[model samples]
Target chain A: MVLELARPRPIWQIMFSTHHTDVGLLYLVFSLLAMFVGGAMAIALRVELFAPGAQLIQDAMTYNRLFTAHGTTMIFLFLLPSAAAVGNYLVPIMVRYKDMAYPKLNAIAFWMIPPAAALVWLGMADFGWYANPPYSVISAPAPAAEMWIFGLKVLGVSSILSSINFVVTILKCKHPDLSLGKVPLLAWSFLTSSIIVLAAMPTFAAALLMLLTDRLGVSGFFNPAVGGDPIAYQHLFWFTFHPEVYVLVIPAIGMMYEIIPRFSRRPIFSHSSGVAAFIILALVSFASWAHHMFATGMSFTEKTVFMVGTLAAVPASAMHVFNFLATMWNGRIKFATPMMFAVGGIALFFAAGAGGVVNTAMPLDFITHDSYWVVGHFHLFVFGTIAFGTIGFVYYLFPYITGRMYNEKWGVVHFILAFVGACITFFTQHILGLFGMPRRIYDYPEIDAWISMNQLVSVGAMIILVGMVIFLGNMIYSMAKGKPANLEDPFGLGGKYYYPFAQRNPQHGEGGY
Target chain B: MAHSNWAEWIYLGVVTALLIYVGAEAWNVERIIDHAPADAEIIIVTGQQWFWTFEHEDGTKEVGELHLKKDHAYKFEVTSIDVNHDFNIPEFVVLMDAIPGRINTVWFSPNEAGEFEIQCREYCGLIHYNMRAKLYVEDV
Candidate 1:
């Protein structure tokens, strides 16, 4: 008697189900949507600042809400989730595990994001993403700030759960033969970043709770009028967020460790050093939080210690950069789309690192504090480095994930436009900041000397908008009609075989257990 | 992967030395605040949401602008009435937070006799962008 094979579930059921890859795909899709939402807000802000006479947004409340939403949506919804998305897709595969240790927990983590994001947009918090209080507590509209705080708390909880899953999965769920020492560098980075998330994110959650109580009039944790020290709030916030910068960048750096070697046709220059860099960055980042509080009244010794901490993290980053350049030294150097962005990311990281050093010098911080220079410095890291790495990975793995290849020429064009546009937008802001322009201001007087530079910044924003449109178009078209990846090792690196397609049944090998 | 390379050690050594140098320079720079003379002009600066109020020791109160004598050291005791703000004079390179219920001091001697910009470096509220004041370093 011939028995009919069990019918597989439909695509819709699978996508909505608790399967790890599908949940990861949902994370990617959600983050992509978040990027557009945040990007649109950014465009509106640039338009209003174009000639500085309140062009698009006339009301101060509207302008405040726009910038606040832009920052919150980007950091919380796009940047963090996108990093998690890459981790979700790659970590289990790299560790040779069938799925994350808790697939249902992963689904819950992804599901928490959408409603939290919705709550943020619904309220449109006007306090800056930093949400410095008593402004966030006493002055800014209550509904919006409270909603933002609630949203952040939920997101933080989701992050903690996700990090736990990652840590446990990496430590305990690897293939039997693979030793901890043999875990790939990308997996090591995820492990390190997850550990950081576990350690650092709870502090933010506690701070958010404190903020909620302060706003609710239940406690004066940050209200100076009631014997609370506002500086304590800054201490708490920066404590979590300073390490957060590493949380944002390290995974992207991990993706670089993966792509740079493959495209350069070399094994990673030094795997041990790369792993050391990740661990070192995590440790040094915690002590460097006070660098953000330089303007706050801290003792000279405190400032010096924080400055040392900030600078101490630099060596690890430098080692990573040195290793990357050395790996690409005299190699085949294929400029695939992924390769272009990886190389660009490392190159831009050098510039960002320089800006960071300048920011670290206690005396120099006086000049660049709260100025467009600081804005430019971070954008170099965020837009130029982190975003570059993430996009490159998407390109590198698109074929593997979708069984379709992205158009190579369009990918190159996308990178060029984004690079030029980002330079025009953020590089000028450094000059403008040096010229004494402060950040978070919605408008400036028309007769100010910054008129021309602001105009240039707006023009650059436009260019970025165009690039983004092309990117979105390219992604959608390619997903639907791009060529099938008929061959393994499509870039022809002749390197070790490490894509996830090897023996899809992950539990039991066809040849051996 | 476990084998340590000499190059890595050398790289770490150079970075450590450079960091120590920068840290030392930073320590020396802290003297900018310490070296203030006892007789320097004192300005008690109070910041609110959208404006700066400079209260000079000589009983002159100025709003939105400060007029100072060039090449004279000025001691600024900055505080905030409502929220956290940073009293920053970009040209003279002075920045310190103006926190409510607390006063922070920073000293700078303006060498350039020109109109410089003073701004609140910390994010306050909606009108934070417009929280600017002019610094006029007139001839002594």
Candidate 2:
């Protein structure tokens, strides 16, 4: 089997294959490609922001386009698809099924990403990721903004289809003896997030269409000039996205679940509570969407309601953090690269959650809204927490996917640089925001605080770029020439484990016992 | 397990109480900020593609600059002539959306006699970053 994976196959064969593993591999590769592309744009933006005025980017419009594309690419192209990649690889195997319930549909879902990504990259829309109107409708450049909408629409449909595949595969294709309660925690994470995608994605899909039509001058759904309310678009967009945040994070948490316990050489501390947290997090995510709109003149009663609604998520998220810490408490811990990333991710998760609490307070919203503080806060979640977990899981799965182990020393180096860089860049932005630097600005008035902090942020971004270079070099070099891994004990932790490939043949091992 | 359950409940209870306290305080702040004094002056602030226009109660219009007397309450009826912009006086934590076809209100009393900056907080267009104005507070 290792040889089979190591051997090169014709491009056409891999492209047309309906196997879940093949599709999963494709999703993983494509998501990594998107990550580097998006990360490049981020570095460009940060470099331009190194000074108060434009240094690398010539104009504000180009900066706008870069950040817009950076945001859209990272969220849709990298984060979501990467989670989907993990789901496709592990869900079927964990459920003791041979392939996804609808294998062709799974393939189709993976295939949709390339064209959607092309549209987003080619158009380079200047509107922000949310594409809020009437700016998106009235003032944004045409064809480019239109392409972004259609691109997102296609991506939305693709994810919906993928969610259906996951739901059916997990629920229907599980072996009869394997009860739903006993299904692996990672599978449960996929189930919860997939259900969320089904519920939350359609609102944004409809809003995107409305925005496109508004731009075409055929509809006035959110065009303030035509008796439409711009706030209505915000309401629709956040309604989908606030929950979409969980959709992006839950899978990473699931990856952590897989990593933390296995690396600690212990069973999960409380399996049931972890499942409960995922469900509660999903439900409460919907309640907090309106919190994003507090500055849009929501009434006192409305603002208070949303503020409390946002706070309601605290305990649920706390449960997961507690679960992880407790799981690692007295267990024999291996400080491997994967474990390091997982532990780092949890610590950052707390910081991100704390920032979120501050943002949710209605009074604090006035101070932080549309400021660099928001930029700092969400990136902590997306980059510090979610990306950390995803990248860690990629390292965890490296041995299984490529039949080779990543260079442990270089992997640790990459983690240290990336973690330190994230801390420097994001934490400084928080202070910068408090110092009155508004977000999405291509230039500032060269205040002392802004200038120094911008320089620090640019330096931090350069560190992360270097770390990413090391990471890519490690993956590519290790794949072709690294030492072969022990199939039974990959990390040299002696324990019984269920390997995905081994599950395909009962003679090799008990299938998902 | 029972002990852990107790700890979890206590943690959640404390969080809930803290959130309630903050919510109530935020509500009070909202009421205080949104409620202008009965004799407060009304300033109709209009935001366009790249500038701000402030019309005083007596129909005195000023573009790119606004003057208010210190220690006097003032209410701003903020709206946009073009797309959606945000009227933000960051130093004072005063912010409201300037949406076309809708007027949103925010009130602040200038306590200090000095000059400050006003900016558009939302992403409106190419020059959204440069969409700024000046505010002058005169001693009463």
Candidate 3:
């Protein structure tokens, strides 16, 4: 007389699954556009810094606005969302579903991007992103602050809709053959990312709403003049921003799960171990949010908890890379273009992620807090890993979606240049930060050595720009004129490896990749 | 054997280059390069309208050019007199978040002390540049 415990089922399920293919494509397209906008701001900032004194954006306030817009647009609007797009698109494919469990809801979620983007960006045309302050706002007849408020609200609404859809989908639509225990590796990351978005985005949405109301002269809290604590804004803001970083990387991990094994022509090294890593990260997201506040003079107890918890995440993450490389071991390796990007993505992820280890040192953070070094570390992880993973995902999966092959030579060309460009642009930043070059400075002093490192980084950025344009061209052209796909396993993995684990006993003829 | 060893050699070569670069940077141990000695300590508390408010802590209880002891340590506890502004001093390698409702503290024992400039790194308003304040560290 024993009772059986099982995964819970919901009252209703809808199966118009947003196939990972469509979501992945959307993610790539959106990120490319974001890269364009964020890069435009960076280029303007670079133009100002190219020589001492004024350039295209002359006012110091104007320069401040550009940097803010660049960071906000890239983080909130571009990269993390691109990762979400990856999750939305690929989860079903990994889970053996035809589409997302709730397709109509998925449509509702995807459809929300543009308007939300509009909300996040509405003030840019007429006013600087920070135009609504005690500082110099846009003198234009209309107040753009309201527009900004509206735009962010719209985007938040969309994020919430997507979260609801994803939660319902993963919980219900998994194949009967796949228990929660046996869910695909990508699905594990997808579910966790969805959970983070659900828990975190709401805080951001509520805060932005209060800001909107405050701007409108109605106190929705957070105004000390009206008895609201200003520090509260930071508390809420970082609550969202910290987990927001994880929101960026988790999807890339999912994409690597799909690509690495295929490129290596091997089955996954260990399924259960990878799932555990994903779960550990999901559970750890809450405790680590406070590391961003270590310099804000938070109490020693909170600081100690966050510091220990943050380092804990490092070990959990190590399990993932170990599993990935293990999957590649003893397997036939194809240095195909997509595989190269995946490999490069993992390498740079380590490089950037390794430096992030420094931030966990509270004393170190005290010295290098908010310096250009932090900037460098962030980009290395973000542009290096998340962005690279996305581009790699699009390249690897393009044929399946569009039924055409990319020119392998050009794909390789794009990958090498982009990887090299990322290294040049972001790697030098570590040196600049160590040299005491604080971030958000429109200009550095004559004797400051940051000049050379910055100049080199700019060159790297230019290379990345060129590589990106070429990759964009590759995507457009490949879809238009590349070879038509005729086989299920387009990667040409040998018969012994495709079906997983069959390589162990070769004579039975069950081996596949 | 040929292929497997080739990969290991490649890995070794890459690791060696990285180690060399790190060794060089560690040897460099680059430190702050500039020096200054100023006549006063001008405390900057950031505010937003959404712009920065640079004011004295005593609220009109103090006077001109931010007077201070020469060559001595003068503390600046950046309280966000108003909305958030991240006060960053590149010369001092100091950055503090002046959250609207809370206080952020950063201590800098200025070597060979002097006058330094501070600006808000966080975008607070159209006049973020105007959110600028002057700091003077004496050579005590």
Candidate 4:
């Protein structure tokens, strides 16, 4: 029973979507499409990386293009949009609002994504994804690279619009029952993540525009040997990149908030503490962007502080982890695959976090900075951690959104295979990295014993791919043939934390502001 | 089901696995002196493009085969003087980079490191792949 907002006549209708639910779903569909594209790119990368001197991926230039596409697509398309989708859906529900205060902007924000995705990646097959066009194939004049940055500009603008809408809605429209103190944990995470996006997206706008201008011969803003340092580009790029990661992770934290409370059968443990930690991490995450520049000759003092700040993240991350654990310490346990993946996610994320610390150390970072170790580290956290967290969240939310129950058995199977395969594929990469394999390299030799490891990684990648296929099969199968949801608590946890918007709570509406 | 509590058990498993992995890698490398003798003279001056520099105790400058006294642990704070380049020798398994404006000091006492080949890694320019020098270790 979707009700269109009939507020302030036609003016408000032009403000936001008629309904935020569809807006949320809109984000979900768009990001899911992106995830598929991003995942395909990952497989292509692994295919090319299977062996040294292997023509499986064409050649050096092609390999570089593949990686750049993969990274850009995964980051810009998959991770960011996934977070936005999760936030769009969950934020309103958590804040006790039926819809964003302005539905018109919500509609606009979401529609902006598809064009950007298509232009940046799908269209880039011709121009190449590299900034330096004619990178791989000679005379293969591809303008895809140009489209990539420009499309990103469009996406950035869209993000800014949505962020403003979410923020205003949260500030003005939360239910009176939900105090800042009483606000659901997921809502707090969303609030912080929205702030992150708002703060960081513009810098990316600046950098991309600079790159675009340079490409067009307007001016080489990034061109060095003319007083422009190449390292500055690295600095600026990571400035956006690092906080951008936090934006992606915050929604995962929100999902964890929803998942943990259900299983624990209790109020969140120390909600205020969790909020404080989020704030600290948000600010600290900004300074640590230079950790990406450890190889770029910044000073010892500079490196020392960044390294210290980088490692200091463990305690903060641990605080949240401990709080989540304590919430469930004495609670009734459910082995639902969603919970399992979320649980596995936190654990595996520690691996990436630990590796992050390794790269944070001045000396260690010097060697491992650009190595495959770093790649493995990020994938472990971002994929094993955040991406896995998303899968779990969506699995739990699937019933609510689709009005059906997935085959739990296959979901579990998919979870284990994908998780195990991801570990096998990525962990071996750390070893290859330590053995002096720089990232984005096309070939590795047989005699170096790297052949076995790369093979294992590729094999693991295939396993994960198969697992993804299985999960997709289950999704289609269940959405079509599965038992219908009882129009009730599909999570079977009753309406303790999650209250459907259809059941309106009166009197407690936007009292604070 | 609650994942937070379950996640602790997961954390326990990762810690055990991490310890095992870290221990194994530690066993393999042991120390800087493991590969070469403590008494052998060696310096790891990581090569960089356009120009070359060293960081030995005697201030590595005067070119033409960096001479070092034998039977001493002479190490160089090897680093890149310019762009990303490495010090590679086919005879020795020790090749470290001199990343621009950064110093990655590697130390090794050459057991038989008499005249080792010091080559630049990537093709930094037209002169890359051919850039090489000889390391002269003295008998003392």
Candidate 5:
């Protein structure tokens, strides 16, 4: 049977093989493990903030390290790697290629992540993820912080290598018959995201190296004591960090584009518009980085320019959202689990984008800056929107990868719990921010109202944790005992887009350039 | 199943409204920036490890706190002694970075007389969470 033939390769082969599929599987496994590690850190953070005072964490130092680890692990360890895993597994397949252009390079790129992640956690760097100077330069525990920087350097190098491989593979190895116009949105997404990675990662690498040298007393690039500007560091850090948000979200939107059409039994409402949106989003990403530094006392003209640049992205995002809605309209909508998650992701992205609008306006940012409101808005985007889209894609591709159908009942339960839990957790934090609560505090002032709001936020975080537990359980259970799926159209939608990776002419032999 | 495509147009209409709202809000921000109160009381706000010190117009200094007259605009010339810190009074909707060796000025008028907390929003060091200052505004 297909299930038997599609069984996972042996452990040794999986570890050592240069095949893109095997390397991609390893990336997924590592990413899942990193997710749990990062998720545990979140639980710790939530439990500490469950009450007003620090009940669980031993001291402020531990709390600081916990959060830094949490942010670093989630952003670098989990989110980026998981996204790469999805891209690595699917891009070649979608392009009808036998393998990535550089399979050995692909394996090397993935293999670098674990050791780099280990270096970060083992050193337990207390510097926050951005690690802005001169605290990062002078005050942080030097050896530990250096390890974190080095780890990030390694991860950056890995991403750049992977990006090169992706670009080459996508551009050169795609099936000759498949023109650029006919490329799947997911492939297009990966291609665009790869270019972004190529462009953005090196700047961060340069920043990290400068930070390392500054920490080691080798240079004074961001050292205020040596006439270097600390604000300059903010400019540099956010230059990459802000576009990094797009780097994470664009691929997610691409995955949603792939899912919605299949579930709606229609082609994307406007493929050209969707492609244009992706390209515009990428181009606009660079223009908006300075918006993150609005509170850093730049001139009014600078602030207005960055604010406009930031808000300018909304039209492209809105275009994509409208296209999604249009695709869903006038179609036989399937209420399948993937469909539910994809739809849920779209809805949350709109809410998150609305919050983004609030953040983008210069005056409103004064109220929300560095408050729990910013925290809430970002979590809504990353967890509520990006995570939802990625999880849906995972489920949508489950049958193709495993040749088995996941438990429909369990998958539905996972989607509902995740969606509801994300809403309860992140949305409440926005109110807490508006109530004047600051973020990254170990213990807050014991004002009664603030305490109550903090408690509510903590409760919501727990709900999200519970939902994630269900999700993890569902993935493990379904992989083992789930029924064999109908290979061509698992949902029986009888649509042209049912199978995402199906070649147009059913050319079985590999015909990629 | 497919329905009338009215929602797409409605969504686009919403986008148009949002863009307009953004333009209006941006102009409001410009007004706030360009028209800072001329007769505001000036305070030199300095940040250090785990605390803040405020020097009033008449040369009296207070650590970890500031006093102000309600309905009077105040401009804070904020700087840090050692590292980067954000001087943020959440209730007053005022935030600016306090960079070492450079003063960043931000102004606000307290409309209500009450005790407000000032938090260092930027990550400074291990005791960053403990960096706090109180603002007490006197009623007219």
Candidate 6:
């Protein structure tokens, strides 16, 4: 099997392959590439922000474009795709299916990303990722914003297609013996999230079209000049995105489920509750969309209702965290790289959730809304918690994909640097927000608190950059030359640690079914 | 198992109850903030591409700087002439969206006499970061 993976097939053949693993590998590599691109932009932004006035970047427009591109790329091209990569690889395998219900559709879904990504990059739309209208419709530069709209539209279609494939594969093609209740937790995450994508994505797709037409002077759906309301666009956008947040994180939670139990060598503490949490989170996500717009002059009753809706998600999220802690309680746990990341992610998830609660309280929202506090809170979720889990899962699957072991010491170093960096950067941003630093700003006055905190935030970002460099180096070097893994017991945790390859592909060398 | 279940129930109940309390308080605060005194002065705040323009009830206009009387309730009818802008006074927690074609209102009484910073919170355009104004709250 190692030889099969090592043997160089033509690049085109790999590209054209309709198999799940090949497409999954493509998703993985592309998303990692997107991460580097987006991370570079973040580092650049941090460098420019190291001081009060601009340092590396020349102008505000460029900075705006950088952040817009950075945000769109990180969410769409990195977080979403990385989760999809994991789902693509594991969902079919966990369901005991030979391949996705529609392999061709999977390949098509992946193929759409590069062109869409190119459009976003080439355009570099300066409007924020939400592309809130009026400015988007009236003031933003032309072809660039138009290009961004088209890019997101295509990407939206791609996600819907991929989601349909996942839904069909898990629900229809699962082995009859493996009932829905018995499906792996990872599959359950994909199942719930994919359902969310199907329901939530179309709203944004329609909004994008409306925005494009408005920009074209064809329609005024969200243009305030033509008897339309800008708030309407925000409603459509957040209705999709508020749920899209869960679509990004649920799979990361699922990855935690996969890692924690195996490393601790215990069955999940409560599978039923985990499943229930995922389902409930999916439902409650839609209710909280308007929480984002509480400061947008929503009615008092409306604001209160959405605040309660936002709070409702807390218990569901807490269920997953508690399940992880309870699973690790009093168990023989190996502090491997994956286990370290899982634990760290849970820690940050707690902080992120606490920040979220504060944000949901309407009076507190007045203080934190659109401030650096919101930036800090969401980044703790997306980058700290979600990215940590996904990166750890990549390490967990390293041996399976490459038939080689990563340098354990280096992996731990990477984890430590990343965790520390995340804490320094995001935690300080929360303080900066309290000191009244608004988000999406290209510059700020040289106030003492702003300058010092901005410097600290930049330094923290640099640390993360160094850690990621080491991570990329470790993966490339280990994949080519590291010691071969023991196929049967990869992590060497004694006595049958749930390696699925042997069961699924009994004929190891004959290539995957 | 029963103990764990009980713990979960108690945790959830506490959370729900706490959320309800917060929500009720928030609603009360919202009402208080939204309610302007019947005789409060009206200031129409207009946000454009990169500056704030204020219109006094007597038709006097000021750009980029607003003068208000301390200890006097002032109601601001905020709107954007161009796009969407968020009128935010972080120190005072006076925030409302200044959207075109719609007048959103926020009211505040300045108890302290000092200079304050008013900035646009929402990302509006290239100069969004520098889209700032000064507020002079003088004792009258």
Listed per candidate, the RMSD to the true structure in angstroms reads: 3.7, 2.5, 9.3, 7.6, 3.2, 1.9
- Deviation (Å) of A88 in candidate 1: 1.4
**Model 5, B45-130: lDDT tens per residue?**
99888799999999999999889999998899999988888899988788998889788899988999999888898877778877
User: Whose lDDT is greatest here?
Assistant: 6
DockQ of each: 0.71, 0.72, 0.17, 0.10, 0.63, 0.73
Error of 1 at A169 (Å): 0.5
DockQ for model 6 equals 0.73
- Writing each residue's lDDT as its tens digit, candidate 2 over A1-513 gives 222255566777767887777788789899999999999999999988888776999999999999999999999999999999889889998898988999999999989989999999999999889898988998899899999999999999999999999999999999999999989889999999999999999999999999988999999999877899889999989999999999999999999999999999988888888999999999999999999888888887898888888988988899899889889988999989999999999999999998998898788888999999999999999999999999999998888777789999999999999999999999999988898788898988867888999899889889989999999999999988889888677899898885455534221233221
lDDT of each: 0.85, 0.89, 0.64, 0.66, 0.82, 0.90
Candidate 4 chain B has its poorest 10 consecutive residues by lDDT at B121-130
TM-score of each model, in listed order: 0.95, 0.97, 0.80, 0.79, 0.95, 0.97
Please report how far candidate 6 places residue B96 from its true position, in Å. Answer: 0.9
**Of 1 and 3, which scores higher on lDDT?**
1
Residues A1-513, model 3: lDDT tens digits: 000001111212111224344444555567668778887888788767655556677676567656766876777678766766666655665565656777666666665676666655655522333222322221222344566557666766777777666666677876778788777777777788778888888887777777666655677365666676655655676777677677778878878887898888777777776788787877777668777766666755666667667766765576677777878999888987878888898898888767866676555665567667787898887888887887788777666555567788888888989899888877787877777666676666554465677778788877887787788788788777778754455566655423221111111123211
Error of 3 at A78 (Å): 3.2
Off by over 4 Å in 6: A1-4, A503-513, B1-4
lDDT of 1 by residue, A219-317 (tens): 999999898888888888998898989989999899999998888887788988899899999999898998988888787888888988899899999
Winner on lDDT between 1 and 4 is: 1
Residue-pair clashes per prediction, in order, are: 0, 0, 33, 13, 4, 0
Interface RMSD of 1: 1.4
lDDT of 4 by residue, A1-513 (tens): 122221122433323444666666667666777777778878987887676665576655556556666777777777777777777776777787777778778888887888887787665532222232111112223475666777878988988888888788787899877678677778788778788888887887887777666656666455532334445555776777788888877778778877876866766666776887788777877877888765444655676566556655555576577777777777776778788888888888778877876666555653565566877898897789888888898788777666678898999999999899989988988887776565555665444567778888899999999888888888879876777655456656555445563422221133210
Q: How far is A479's C-alpha from truth in model 6 (Å)? A: 0.6
**3 against 6, candidate with superior lDDT:** 6
Model 3: residues with Cα > 4 Å off, grouped in runs: A1-28, A60-65, A125-142, A443-448, A496-513, B1-71, B88-95, B99-103, B111-119, B126-140
Candidate 6 lDDT by residue in tens digits, A168-202 = 99999999998999998999999999999999999
The stretch of ten residues in a row with the least summed lDDT in candidate 6 chain A is A504-513
Docking class of 3: incorrect
